[model samples]
Target: DDIAEAVISLEIMRDRATAHREDFETLYAAMHGLYSWFLRVCDADGKEYALKQHEQLFETWGATLSGEQSLSPLESAGLTQESVGDVMRALSAASKYNQELKEQKERMSGAALNTCEKVLNPLKFLLSNGATTARDYRVVIEKTLSDTEKALSTQAQRSSLARLPMDELVKIQFRCLNPALAFRELVGENGARSVILTSGTLAPLNSFASELGVDFPIRMEAQHCVDMNTQVWGSIVASGPSKRVLNAGFKSRSDWAFQDELGASLKEWAKVVPHGMLMFFPSFSLMEAIVHRWR
Candidate 1:
């Protein structure tokens, strides 16, 4: 049966990890077993004989989280066992990081993992199950975007990172649906409080509907920009002689020696802008090089 195969797969992992059974690898494998078992039961087309063999599993056990599934998670979550394992590890690390963040001192490595976990957990759950635990979706939205921002920040290229915040791009995946999970929940009381999957052109009343899963009817919406004028809208490029093509727009500010001058300009701008802006440096060591010729 698909269910048995799934469980066996996880158990094998557990057996290998018994030396450290409670280790992340072990817990992840266990969760994987539980999750994949549900998938096989819902698959009428996957393996008929196996589905029949384990159909009783669902009948005997309480309905698992059958109400949460989506498609994007399936694709983005990846398929290779190692890739899945790596992502799961990143997510688990992120979850631990988020929990610790609510308290005290932290692991720098975990900071990135925490955000990645937030992004992937809901996605993985949806892929495995057919419905999303709304809470997981929100977490994915939060961490995925944060990590994306962090990843992008480390890069010398911002223009290529795209315009939408990392969070929005990551969360865009929740729009995908998992039919089997939806049907499983619709069979009984284990379904969502309400689910309205429809389309409309004009709708955006709720404030957090997009963030929260509350926006009953998901659809495209018209946008209205602020009456206020653009305060600041620009771009940044990598700083270095070899990558000097970036000096096009800011010819006056282009001299490598003028790096300090740019910082001073930022300071001057900050006197009025307060904490609204941010200044990024390639590396702290570059401080001497940049400031020495400070523009």
Candidate 2:
């Protein structure tokens, strides 16, 4: 009976995969044509803008850099010190904005590659082989199908919007409402001897186990090896060595003063600490920004 049910499920999955593959092919062709149009438009705009004005501006800037010309030309052209400063700041902002766009483009490309490899390729192979059994590949097939369906939904919406004439694109987000289903899929069906989950933050063991839909037959709560009184100590560092308040709030976290003070405090600690020290940040981006500034 179970084998028959599995065969039925596999048949349904094959039908769905066939439909999704057709839709993806159509969208891919449309996007390719649209992208070609975009490239032509960008090329025309670049030639017009760069040849007319930016060419001269860049020449003047280069001359100034090489000490072959003075700021007098720019000043004579009605550009003041403040105006030049503003232009530099604007260029800096544009550079950062372009960098963010590049990163987003790379992430989207990665997602497309994952869908092709995990969903489309596997589905294609299964269909070609005329496989009827889902017992072995059930977990992989279900996960990939779910991912492809979600991607197709998002792509369809985005493709519709792309057909319209718009200056900015609307963002569409897909969030998982039931995280436990994903956890259950990982641990429920697949046969394994034992699954051990170890983490310092898994304090409420009962709730964690319940969420995972798994029972721990043997549980152990190990004590800290270091003595809290002598070997281990903790303190709240409200201010840095420079006496600047260590406020890691959203607005203050990015401030140069705060970063400098924090770095200075860490350096002092590193000098005194015996073996090593561990520093934690609220977020990876914040840590990256601080480290970039230091470098």
Candidate 3:
């Protein structure tokens, strides 16, 4: 019986691992299922009654019922038919633990909801010319563990779970753009031509905006903004490349003969060398015109 409940609990958690909104629901259902099971096989008469109740419950719920519930430690013990005193103790302990878990879950949920309001509502409430009010909106995370900590001055960290049909993704969204920036997939240099780097702190943006520079550059153009919060940076480069290449995801034609002839003609004007040979036709139309003339 204990083993059966363990199996059921694992299956339930596995099913629910993808969602946060239904986390507690999963927990309750799992405990309820297991708890009901304990009464099912409690005795022949009680077991039959429990089984009937379970059948009715399953029928009513059908596939709508979650299968991702977990059994608490005490509930786990209660599932096993050990000593009567031991079983009682386990059930009592499990109930107490569940209550504490409920309280903590509620706390985090409320905190997270409030954080959402603070971040999103202001965007809607645009800064009017009206006066502003000061309220205690910041978080106050009170930890009672051995690790000492200071008062929280900002929002708390939060993780959200997205639920798909059979999968779940854990996501963390930044509430404020603080400290560092999160960049996406970087573009690679297909062929080198020119490269320029600049930053607000750069002594001379035109000279060379390296991490640290002692290199050669006769000219420079850069100045820092006195404002402690203002900063800007960028890069630029020039190159003369003339190369004909076919790369992955190129939605071109299947006419290999036409491609080969076009490549040969391009090699005639600009050397279709390994890497450094890029045509700088004014635009796509100009290139197409040239291609038409060549063909």
Candidate 4:
């Protein structure tokens, strides 16, 4: 009965999305459907429904891929496959994306509401880009993100957008679990046949390699796209008017005099810059206070 409800909810959402023909509406419907589906799947005995669905779809695709059998594709199923081969490919992508969605849900449990966007962004990309036949899957990704955002908004203490970066966007993270050990387990107990880690910021290769438990890893530096010496600029302002050290370190964070000085410095900087600028405060309370003072 719950499974039936979930299916019905998704169908209704799909209809609404089609009617609206807007990404936001489509995404909302998809997210709502996923939330319903998640509730049902999580309630199922042994929580095996979602896993079984992916596996069964995978087997169907595998048989088609191997030319063992042929099945008629139907637009109703969103299969619309050109042939048994196309159907199989579509099914394979759907299966993979579905699996990813499941993983994302599990990982996001108990996480801050604001963190949902970052967590769901990768799954969204996988469905929208790599999973061509997964129109339904793509919808689910959008829906999940929508649901997550809504959930996070209810939390009064969650970090605001200015402070957070979606993992899929910036491809950087801090103060979170390292994905290295998980990657090691995924490729193999030992590791993949060949593992390549390349990033411009991945300098001090030894430090990174050691953290990932890689032994004697080969390293190479790619050619720079521009001259760093000519392009890069920096500044240091270490002292205040009285030659007293000016710092916003944790020890001096709550000092009102320090904050006032910092604000004055920022105001001076703003006057020099013509267009616009951004200021990052350590905490929301501090930002609110600064803004109030400025006003």
Index of the highest-TM-score prediction = 2
Candidate scoring better on TM-score of 1 and 2:
2
Instruction: Give residue 5's lDDT in candidate 3 (0 to 100).
Output: 32
TM-score of 4: 0.30
Please report the TM-score between candidate 1 and the true structure. Answer: 0.22
At residue 269, what lDDT does model 2 achieve?
A: 88
TM-score per candidate, chains pooled? 0.22, 0.40, 0.15, 0.30
lDDT of 4 by residue, 1-295 (tens): 2222323333333344322223323333333443443333233231322222223112111101111110111122232233223323332443343345455532222222223233333333222222232321211111011112212132222322122212111111112133443454445667578877678887677777766656645768776787879975668988655455667674465566676777677767787877887767788986786567556
Instruction: Give the top-scoring candidate (lDDT).
Output: 2
Regions of model 4 farther than 4 Å from truth: 1-200, 215-220, 240-244, 273-295
Q: For residues 1-295, could you state the per-residue lDDT of candidate 1 as single tens digits?
A: 2222323333443455323334444434434543343343334332421222222112121121222232333333243323445556644653554455454432223433343344445444444423333323321111111333333332213332123333321112243233343344443466566655444423444643543434346455554454325754566544433333333232234354345445555566677775587655655655555666553
lDDT of candidates 1 onward, in order: 0.39, 0.42, 0.31, 0.39
Evaluate candidate 4 by giving its C-alpha RMSD to the native, one decimal.
18.9
Per-residue accuracy of model 2 over 1-295 as CA lDDT, tens digit each = 1111222322332344322333333323323332333332233233411312223112111100111121232233323334433433332343343345465432223333233233222222222212221111221000001112122233334343233222311111122233454455456667556678798778678887876667888898777666768976767999998789999885477688889989999999899988998889988998998999888
Regions more than 4 Å wrong, model 1: 1-73, 76-86, 93-111, 130-295
Task: Tell me the lDDT of model 1 at 277.
Answer: 79
**Model 3 CA deviation exceeding 4 Å by range:** 1-251, 271-276, 279-295
